[model samples]
Target: MDDEPIWDVDRVVALTPSSAITIPETTNEFVIKGNHLTLIKGNQLDGRTKTDPHKHIHEFLRICDMFKYRDTKNEVVRLMMFPWSLTGEAKTWLDELNEGTIDTWDEL
Candidate 1:
């Protein structure tokens, strides 16, 4: 309609975090195994009914525990893998968080 204002995507800035998760350096190669990724992807959270957030968190932690990297803290692995465990609204919520707001697992 003539009365409606046009939306400008170029003028809009993406509010991406400067450092959502700070991954600690590791002496050994830090790689997310396909099996682990597959498992986490299988248990993704969509922030919808019928999906238990608490359960997802617990399961995520459990999967993270199965992975280990020298000089890399467990929390670092958790932080790196947490994003993969989300989808739909859950992923959208994480993406919309303020810049540099989350730098630690506790903060996340």
Candidate 2:
């Protein structure tokens, strides 16, 4: 399933790879995949947090999970959960891509 993106201010937050973002307080499970953030609510048993009042609770990211990206295709791509520490060469690669100095991914 897919949901269309709306690039409005209230919808997304600009982010960099180094940005530190918090997952929800109650959730023990968190997921970050290609342009998606998913949180699985738990049963508090004490009736503190509702299991899920909505049907599609895990279907989309909350407002906090949304982030901005810089892509030419405008196809949303997200950082992987276990991000590999990038080398300094990544910046040079980004510079080349941004400046249109590289013609192919092999140059990266």
Candidate 3:
């Protein structure tokens, strides 16, 4: 078998709450209520530089996709918090994101 990470049921359930999934474009600011996540027009959020709301939303969507696919919750969380530590399946998802293969909120 290939050395790719395969998602399983346990991982999906475990990582569902670590972050919010990106909701389809509906507003111009970041929105996170209950399990609904949205993003609006803006570049600066919580005083973080080079942090675009749209990009953040996309990242969340990617993470959500990883979770949906069964990537380990802990590894997914680590990738979001510390990308430098990316390895195994987490790295695969990151690569997919970079390659624009992961589906966007609208696509989902």
Best by lDDT: 1
Which digits, one per residue and each the tens of the lDDT, describe model 3 over residues 8-32?
3143222232223232333234222
TM-score to native of every candidate shown:
0.74, 0.17, 0.21
Query: Candidate 1 has what TM-score?
Result: 0.74
- Name the regions of candidate 1 deviating beyond 4 angstroms: 1-14, 17-19, 25-29
- Model 3 accuracy (lDDT, Cα): 0.34
Runs of candidate 3 exceeding 4 Å displacement: 1-49, 69-108
Off by over 4 Å in 2: 1-89, 96-98
Candidate 1 differs from the real structure by a C-alpha RMSD in angstroms, to one decimal, of 7.6
Better of 1 and 2 by TM-score: 1
lDDT of candidate 1 over 69-107, digit per residue (tens): 667788877888888998886786677666666777888
lDDT of each: 0.74, 0.26, 0.34
Candidate 3's displacement at residue 30, Å, is 25
Model 3 lDDT, residue 83, Cα: 28
| Superposed Cα deviation of residue 56, candidate 3 (Å) | 0.5
